[model samples]
Target: MTTIELTAEEMAFAGKIGFYRDYENKQRSNIADYDTKRFNLTSLQAHRLGVMCEVAVGKFLGLDMLKQPPEVWTGFVVSEHYEFNKGPDILNRFEVRRANVRTSPIPLRKKDLEYSAQVVQVYVPYTQTADGISVPTQCELLGWSDSVEDWPKAETPSWSKNGQARVVHNKRPMSDLEVMV
Candidate 1:
């Protein structure tokens, strides 16, 4: 496992794509526009940011996002609409979840099991400003159970505001987890 700590510049660059909650729907926006007018962004920018984060995580893990496994590479070759697939974002098979703070738990949807058999969780911690702009700070490889059955047992049941089933687990501490770069 490797650890990658993102620099202030990298994080700030990632912050260009931002999100906001409008009533029940979560809206995307450009940070620059938000700073001035707090306007929403097109779906294109949101999709691009998702790909960027995935690529950044893959690069940190030493995998070339363009030349990795078909599944991983396919994630990068997308525009307009984005597809949500099961498993990790990188070819190394570590399930990656990005959170606003280091202490935030990784919330894995109950139905997604594509990468549940994998034993490692690449938890990326990021920081966001008061206005909802954010940048990823660091990545940690959390060694979890290999058995998919163990995952549900390890997580605490919770429901999203929209009535979706989910589980959250704190797992190992950020300091104790191995760093992957």
Candidate 2:
């Protein structure tokens, strides 16, 4: 069984930080009707969060690398609310709710394949007022998805409040056109 541990610094630097943004996707027909403004984090944040998730999933799955070098740490999904420095004193609140470490298959140019491991995480954030200021009091990680697109589509696990679990399977067949043509 793998036993992964995180140093203080490692834990601090890793994990996804949610940010606010305006989403503009013409591909979605319904998107045009509603105000696009929403809180969203960057893809980089999401990827980092995935790493943090590994720490938890590794423990759950009992993988062997949890004790080795280049130690794998699962990703974290963090939901946070930050108030203007002048307006609020609370910085953030977060929780690691669900984590998963799993291997994904990748195709090689030589008609071979390899398995790459990744972590997924999900969480939520909430804020409330205290002492005349809004403060982040809760942040939760709900679950994880191996791929970016699959992340949202994945289901949360039963253990999580809104947890839905998702497993990715890469089974796309390779075309032979490039092998000879």
On TM-score, the candidate that comes out on top is: 1
lDDT of 2 at 109: 12
Supply every candidate's count of residue pairs whose N, Cα or C atoms clash at under 3 angstroms.
7, 29
Model 2 regions more than 4 Å off? 1-39, 62-121, 124-181
lDDT of each: 0.44, 0.28
TM-score of each: 0.48, 0.25
Taking the tens digit of each residue's C-alpha lDDT, what string does model 1 give over 29-81? 43321221221334433433444455566665466554554455444222221
Worst 10 residues of 1 by lDDT: 30-39
lDDT of 2 by residue, 1-181 (tens): 1324544444443332111111211223322211222223334333344344434333333443224222122122111211222111111111122222223322111101112112223332222235322212222223322233434444433323222233334422222111110
lDDT of 2 at 176: 12
